[model samples]
Target: MANDGLSAGAAARRLGVAVTTLRTWHQRYGLGPSRHEPGHHRRYTVEDMVRLQVMQRLTAQGVSPAEAAAWARRAPSDASLSGGSPDASGGSPELTAADLAGFPSAAPHPGASGRSGVSSDVAGGSADPVDSVPAARVGDGEGGAPADLAGGAPADLAGATPAGLVGSAPAGGGQTIPLGPRANPAARGLARAAMRLDGPSMRYIIEAAVTGRGVILAWIHVIMPVLIGIGERYEATARFIEVEHLLSRTVTEVLAAVPRPPRDREPRTLLAAADEEQHTLPLEALAAALAEQGVPTRLLGARVPSQALLDAVNRTGPVVVVLWSQLPGSGSIDQLERIQAVPHPPLILAAAGPGWPVEGLPPTVTTLGDLASAVRLIARATSD
Candidate 1:
């Protein structure tokens, strides 16, 4: 930075974000350059840069822009100017992807141990209070009223269901997706948000989960359960497809919003959905998880016909290709066969998602069982 300070373009480059994004933060959130000289454009001083970095990091982790800005504005000047130590109101230290990777696969239910202190109150209490309460454990056997995860007082879900959803349910019951007793509080909160079709609250909860827990944990513990419950509801009642669509769309947006590796780093990994397969949320989660690990990927969302995928493979020459399938109709072995027979095949061709048949898979193809394993395998292959 010059003594005068850095121009908006320079600051955006240093932050790896768009100039327009910076301008929006300035206009909407009041996070802008403070240094100005006579008859000269305002420039970002080191202190301003530090604030912007804090804003950028928080928002990237899934914090709402307004809340993130509030924290950014409060960042201490003594904090590292190189985007280190946000220290916003004495929050927990940021967890890197490596740090999150060591977390146990089975996260304790929020009620098992009191809710983790990491606050989920980003929605400013506008979202239903029930969502903030910890979920009840399934087999506690001490049958009593449901207790709030935070305060250990009784809580109710009867009123949480929105009026609009009442008619959407079958005659047998009111609007509710049956998340079994074992569901975590985050997952339960997500289910309620989905039922209400509240996009902003849904994004906040999902993003907070991703930021606090890694993408893999967020998907497994928070997202995947809600999706499964919704799918079951749709199967039984043959309704609430709108809820499913909206939730899926929100998850897609959040995962896509996860920051990618810098533009300078060429992506060596490719991800795609099989032909006619519309379910790509898992792949999106995989892509975001990889990005957290500093690996760039080319995500060809939704359905990809065999030739187009091959064309992409040939053009990009990616070292690793992951093909996802969510149903049997889309899982064609010939796609894998064609990719393997390419003039110069990728080092790893992975068959991910439940769509692939357990038998008759090509020996050269790797099958990914879950998000964490997929990240580890592809990240390793790309690094190699």
Candidate 2:
């Protein structure tokens, strides 16, 4: 086909790379379609852009330009890029534990199974595996709570479990709603309480919980905010350990029941950490949502070294890296700057909680307090 279509600049923009780099790939690697234009300026076709995009993903995955070019040469046809491949182009179908970085599971799409490695249950093995919410309303931990909320004490959920509901709705209930923003006051309260938590303590609760929708929401909204409030209260004046302990134990149970989402196409490799000089709860909430959205995620937890983060990015090539700081210190700012310098940086750098003193963080760097905001951000990015 003739290549007298898209301009070099447009093609570069679509490929998320510079025009010069595209030109270099075209020249040195024999990539790109034949370029031609009535005005004699190079014009790349949609095919050229598609090839470039495939090359970009391959290169991001650590493939060399030459090897990426070779792979792109055999990539999907141009037709596949136009509203095809499940949730837009170049999106992964399977989200790993690492992809669960900033939001609930993304909506399902036909192409969600495009890539491999996602568990068979998530891929399409059996919808029943995902339908396993307990029949009884599990305690929110406001009353006489047990020690093992999600740590495999059968007694906790045993009463709620029914033999017939194993692969579908509970005996008397309906279908499970996808984990998302709920207008329920309970969800809002959870979000509010979590906003007060620092990240580390919050993460301890989430990572330790079982995977289910209810558990996921409680962790994102309730436990997270409560912890933040406790941290703030501690900063102001000493507080009783009983209050913190109650909050932690209660929230930990909620997270243990939330199930990871089926499959999503968002990039895997999620990163969350307490900012160099900050707390970690906001990041923990973000990570939980990411898991629900089906993005594979990994939380480095509190006090990660800037060098360690950079190395992780280079080694893992995660699609997004989230940095949460309830209180941003000079060290946090310095580390943030260093991360921004990494090549082809993660899709987002987010902060939440408090004390972000920087004047102008990048547009992609966002600060959020609740699960709703994180869900929307990841959902939009995944669809795009």
lDDT of each: 0.60, 0.40
**lDDT by residue (tens digit), candidate 2, 142-218:** 11222111111101111111121112211221211111222122222232222222223234334433242333444
User: For candidate 1, which ten residues in a row score worst on lDDT?
Assistant: 116-125
By summed lDDT, the worst window of 10 consecutive residues in model 2 runs over 113-122
Q: How many clashes in candidate 2?
A: 47
TM-score of 2: 0.40
TM-score of each model, paired residue for residue = 0.58, 0.40
Task: Check candidate 1 and list the clashing pairs.
Answer: 134-149
Among these predicted structures, which one has the highest lDDT?
Answer: 1
**lDDT of model 1 at position 148:** 12
